[model samples]
Target: MKTKNNIRVGISIGDINGIGGEITLKAFEDSRMLEFCTPVIFASNKVIAFQKKHFGLEVNYNGVHEASQAVEGKVNIVNISKNAPKIEFGKETEEAGKYAFLSLKVAVEALKNNEVDVLVTAPINKHNIQSEEFRFPGHTDYLAKELNGEALMFMVTEDLKVGLMTDHIAVKDVSENITRNLILKKAAKIHDSLIRDFRIRKPKIAVLGINPHSGDNGVIGTEDDTVLKPAVAELFEKGIMAFGPYSADSFFGSDSYKKFDAVLAAYHDQGLIPFKTLSFGKGVNYTAGLDKVRTSPDHGTAYEIAGKGVADYQSFKEAVFTAIQIYRNREEYEELTSNPLKKASGNNR
Candidate 1:
């Protein structure tokens, strides 16, 4: 099934000091991976060499100038800057953060210019990567700004899909941020993603409550009734199949998340804690409602295992698979919508 129009995946080397290099190398170690798509990594040749040696990887990569020249069965590294920062494993430093941003910045530019079909970013330390130029909370926020679109942090896997409306924000401000308008916007984005990217034409979404037991009918709090219920009604009026201000605890407890296409949580840990708990090494963090495809591993930089070659690459591999699937699904969805009789198909992405 390999074709000339294989989707190109651009990968960003995360923290030079972390396991980004390890997992990335491991993910592409199999030559069969190239059968699906060509991969372009944004990192200096010197840095990649260090990572390969340090991790004792057997895979070989070709240092290419641009994404267009990427070769199948060969890892292509788009060397960003002739020189790169020093690698200091198990330690957080400014240089690690700088090069991490550099790799991401270069890969993002390639994606924006249509040189790459999708972006698969590695993990970066949110604290260390913060600079005056890059001030966003994480990849989702930064890409949302650069790409000029709202991003829903959609965590995906074979089993379930969960979206966080309030991500990377403090818990104290969670209640104040759950406005009706914000709910509607996130709901719309989720709907669009399910239809276009996931190929679910008539998708049903479940929304979780902000407070305990959905405010227990105003005993625990009032926002669940005052904000969430009305927001769900408004979304229903707009023809979106959104339900609940469901209780955070009981929803996942009873395995009710299995009943919907996607679940939108009021806050970060309210959803991710359970998602990660269930699908830790297999989850793909996808940024939906964007002009281009972007995904990352559900986990973060594990400095303790940096350069050890023991990091599990399953999540990173799933990220690449998910990005490619989304890109293809979006293309097919557009094709079908553009021509009704062309192909009324069900997706396997």
Candidate 2:
């Protein structure tokens, strides 16, 4: 059972061959983590035991048949599978992908059923975790389909938040993929997420340009002038407090990002490169504008350091913390907005 302070966190074990298990276990090594939220790992107890032995970790876990059976102050394992997949370090295998999907599927179901308060996913191998049933580029896309609301990949930290206009698409297709409607939709998502999830009353958003110097008045390209600029103007006029078609090259370099609450980049690399460079080990990839909260570490499955037991779990721990914070923020926001009269009286006081 979860208390007001302790939320149930549903965790999907990403790629059995990667650093998911390592980071997950490492984060829970500190017993203080359990004081805030009950963790429900969607994997087998045997697998977790194997990981513990391999990593030489002494953390104990409670094995249960379902997430609802999870108890506070303990790491709970919801044994989703009887036969645990073999762990092959630093390799992307079909078996690893299978189990990864299984873990994610069950965890998502629990989230939809309201059995879990929030979800913190470990990294999954984008190549191996593909099938007839599961055919999305990443967690954001799949979650958009499963959950209610439009999904935006909002990479966040204490001081920085970056959202992508286009994610998991080829660079050549980026310009075509980014349209006026797309920019409006993504920017709106970012604006709402900052206000609702981050507790920002009003958010200023920066949109990065698509071309060099934002097309340099059509000398380099026309997309920025024709598409991005107009979209940003429309957003601003509609009271979104959005600015830019700012040159991507100099925006972060000049520390212009510090002026805004969040940034909406044209593409994946445009946003992630700067985000990772600045806060790689401390950032959380939050799926914003979703009915439920889902977050992951900024970094992916570090295959090279998968089974070495030296993988940094700071980002994973931060992901957990961010998810919990956002969940609480949403709860508070809903409570305050549910009754306008109460909100008005409280405001007057």
Candidate 3:
């Protein structure tokens, strides 16, 4: 029901020792970005100054103590910490992890309170960020819990959209996690996101197999045949347009994914490897089915080149753009659904 001309994007400056700050600043280097959206980075002024000095950057940001005090047309730094820990590039310390959690926690709180429209998170070191405060595997789980919604790790790009059924779990646990209900839930989220977030009508979803050759007609494994096949059939019966437990190995190689609107992979690597391989620098990881918009770059914290100022920001930029677009799409969808004439007009066009 609420709408705005300029989207307020809340950003969580990920690991202070990593390339998160570098990429966040680089994404806003082009002043043209501020024309559409205002970025509020949940970080301390000390950390920003340290990184700026290290990179020799001369960017201007509005340093505010609260989210409501954020200014448009500039990077808004919401100071979560007074005296930031010392700068230690290319190093993983407890302090870096602590700040990373603080940044994410504050940004998410702002998002929950509707202080911002969407969230674009920077790269976080999984190992370092694991403290008593944040015990989840990654951002997806934390965001899901905070927003009171399920998270589908949706890898989005111009070429394709891939969603994982199981995320951040080990190989041993993947099989146990792949249940009929899990598949159905992820497929529904991806399907709903296609229509609501991406504005796709009549989405055709492709399902990837858990085993090689879709379990080779039950000669290898029966999960794909027994579990996945029935799940796809159920989805199709509900008018979801879902198909196949196709062999993961050959599906991408054959370029068959071009025919579908989105693909549901059985596990993490089964989906991400191919998605990242195709759109390594440009892909955006959208957490679909969340009440609020949240997205991240496909890549992680580049500790090797933390202070080199060479980390690619294309993916981060795309994540920001994707969050804005999804918010707009959601608003438009609500407007159309509320009015019969507008809904009819939209369908006709």
Q: Provide the overall lDDT of each model, using Cα atoms, as 2-decimal numbers.
A: 0.90, 0.93, 0.90
Predicted structure 1: clash tally? 0
In model 1, which runs have C-alpha deviations exceeding 4 angstroms? 1-5, 343-349
76, model 1: CA deviation in Å?
A: 0.4
TM-scores vs. true structure, each candidate:
0.96, 0.98, 0.97
Which is the leading candidate under lDDT? 2
| Ranking of all candidate structures by their lDDT, best first | 2, 3, 1
Write down the lDDT that model 3 would get: 0.90
Clashing pairs in 3: none
Clashing pairs in 1: none
TM-score of 2: 0.98
Model with the higher TM-score, candidate 1 or 3: 3
Tens digits of per-residue lDDT for model 3 on 1-349? 4444368999999998889999988888788888879999999888888888788777788899988888877889999988788778899998888889999999999999988889999988899899787899999999888996788899999779999999899988887789999999999999999999988988999999998889999898888878999999999998899999888998998999999999999898999999989886899999999899999999888889888888889999999999999999999888988899989987897
Q: Give the range of the ten consecutive residues with the poorest summed lDDT in model 2.
A: 1-10
Q: Taking the tens digit of each residue's C-alpha lDDT, what string does model 2 give over 54-101?
A: 999988999999999988889999999999888999998999999999
